[model samples]
Target: MGALDGKIAIVTGTSRGVGVGVSRQLLLAGATVVGCSRRPLPGLPAAEGLGGVEGRAEQWVCDQGDHRAIDAFVQRVVDTYGRVDILVNNAGGTVPTPHAEDVPELVQQIQSSPASDDDFERTVAFHAYAVQMNLISPLWFAIRVYRQMRTQDGTGSIVNISSGAGHPAGSPSLVSYGAAKSGLNHLTRSLAEEWGPKARVNCLALGPTMTENFRAFVLGEQDPEGRAYFANVPLGRAGDPDEVGRTCVFLCSGEADYINGTTIEIDGGMLPGVLYDAGLKTITDLL
Candidate 1:
């Protein structure tokens, strides 16, 4: 049997990226996954049967940034599933990345200049909202899951996906974003401390990972800056979606019951020296 046999899970932002990868991995481990994204549900890719993995998912259209939408979506899961076994609150943000031509200088500009109101507003919205989607929303489901799990099975896990932007990899123009994720990283500590040995909480601070957004900027580089940006990565490459997915599964499994309130950095060691080389800001820049 699978580590998660007979479990029900909620995964947000299922239309693509890590959400897609995580959901697939959970399903393989024997879960009935309820996934959501702003995109139309029917358009989602269908289920596939992989060896040693048997699972499936149902899709929902929910813009996680909208408080009401988050409510309704979680309600749907509780209504249908009767109880929630796992939650991966990963809607991220509402803002979409612009086309390369429209914002080709974003990286450089964010680095060179001090932050402006516009920068705080935009990046804060994305990262702060990431906290809401990644923390608050899951808290909602976690409460109900905790009640049900304790009464029934006595276990559950909440995993939040974060970014190294909040770590020593400190971003330049991303003051708001980094601060927001830093808040999330802290929440993992708080939640684990308060809700330990019953409902586990953890965060993954990822770095230089490949996703649809990363690809849009890197794949068709056609520029020296873009090439140099990735060259600094210690791994010499972007992380696969499946790698993040596997980590999610491991955190959710019973094996991780003792591991709570921790922030695991999963970026192939792309912090400090590596991030500095990428032109991202650090303490030295602040001085």
Candidate 2:
């Protein structure tokens, strides 16, 4: 049997990207997956290697930022599945902008060149608000599920999606996004403490992964920047969506019952650098 057989899971922001990947993983593990995104997924993809157990995947269209919609969506899942065993809060993104240094150069670039109010607002809304959807909305769903789990004498898991960007000092251009993810890490810890032995809560801190969105929107047609970015990576490439999905599945499985209130970094060793690389400073200097 699959690790998550008979479990019921809710995965948010699952129309595409890592969210979709995580949903696919949970389903493949024999969980009944309720996948939510701003738009509905056309259909669940077939699991290639998993001999016979073709898992079930259901799609829901809801704005995670909308608490009411999220509440209704969670209720629908619980009503249909009878219990909620796992939650993966995975919807979030950075504000679109020109290359990190495409804008006009000016004196006092460090202090004066920070993102604008609009950028901050948008980033907070996307990153911070999305996290809130994962944290607060799931709390509402978890309360219902927890009550049921208590009745059945059962336990559940929660995994929040974070980023390596949240680890370092913070990025000026993506300050709000980084801060929001950092806050998510703390939120995971706080919730784990609150829920305790009854329910497990953890954060999956991811590194750069190659998503279709990243390729089309951020990387652009030529993808020079994207190529350079991945070239610098120690792994020599961006992570696959399935790698992240597998990690999520493992974290939610019974094997991870003892693991709680932690952040798992999945960045392929991008943070620890043996060399004194001043790429950012060098780029700024050149500009």
Candidate 3:
């Protein structure tokens, strides 16, 4: 039997990217997955090969940023399934694009005009949205699910999907996204401690993973610097979503029963002070 046979799981943001991988892995492990996204979940590409997967999945719509939507989503799951065995707070990707009209002004402000009130307000607005989606939404989902999970017969697992940007060194380009994820990492630990043996909470801080979004925006065929981004990684390549999915599986399975309140880095051993090429050059120059 699969490790998660007879379990019920809730996975958010399954319309694309890491959520797809997480859902695939859970279904393969024999858990009934109820997933959500702004759009319907798409068919896993032919290569994903669902031939042997024991469990099944259903798609639902949810806007994680809204507390009412989260409440309705959780209620629907519980009302239909009678219990929730796992929750994957996997919805996020809130990098705000500066308005076209303000781009030049923002650039000018960065170099010369320090008091750009409009620019500052724009950034704060984006940051607030990012925090709402990445941090507050996950918190709400965890709170709602934990209430149901604790009442169940055995332990329940909550895995918060974070990003490597959340690391202490922080994400310069993705400031707000990184800050929100950092909050999520801390939330994982705090919730795990607060909701003890009855429920376990963990965080997965991901590095560069090859997902649909990655293919479209970050590492597309036309991007020359894309592959260069992985040069410092010991593994010398971005991780695949399936790899992340497997890790999520392990974290949720009984095999990981003892692992709680931990933030596991899914990046291929890329640490702080060593990720950037300049950082590598500084160390090599010393040698």
Task: Please report the candidate that would top TM-score against the real structure.
Answer: 3
Root-mean-square deviation of candidate 2: 6.2
- Over 116-152, each residue of candidate 3 has an lDDT whose tens digit, in order, gives 3576655555566667878998999999899898888
Using lDDT as the measure, what is the rank order of every candidate, best first? 3, 2, 1
lDDT for position 18 in model 1: 77
Least accurate stretch of 10 residues (summed lDDT) in model 3? 278-287
User: Cα lDDT for residue 182, model 3?
Assistant: 94
Candidate 2, residue 7: Cα displacement in angstroms equals 0.6
Better of 1 and 2 by TM-score: 2
State each model's C-alpha RMSD to the native: 6.4, 6.2, 6.6
Q: Rank order by TM-score, top first?
A: 3, 2, 1
lDDT of each: 0.65, 0.66, 0.76
| Model 3 RMSD in angstroms | 6.6
Candidate 3: C-alpha lDDT: 0.76
Q: Choose the strongest candidate by lDDT.
A: 3
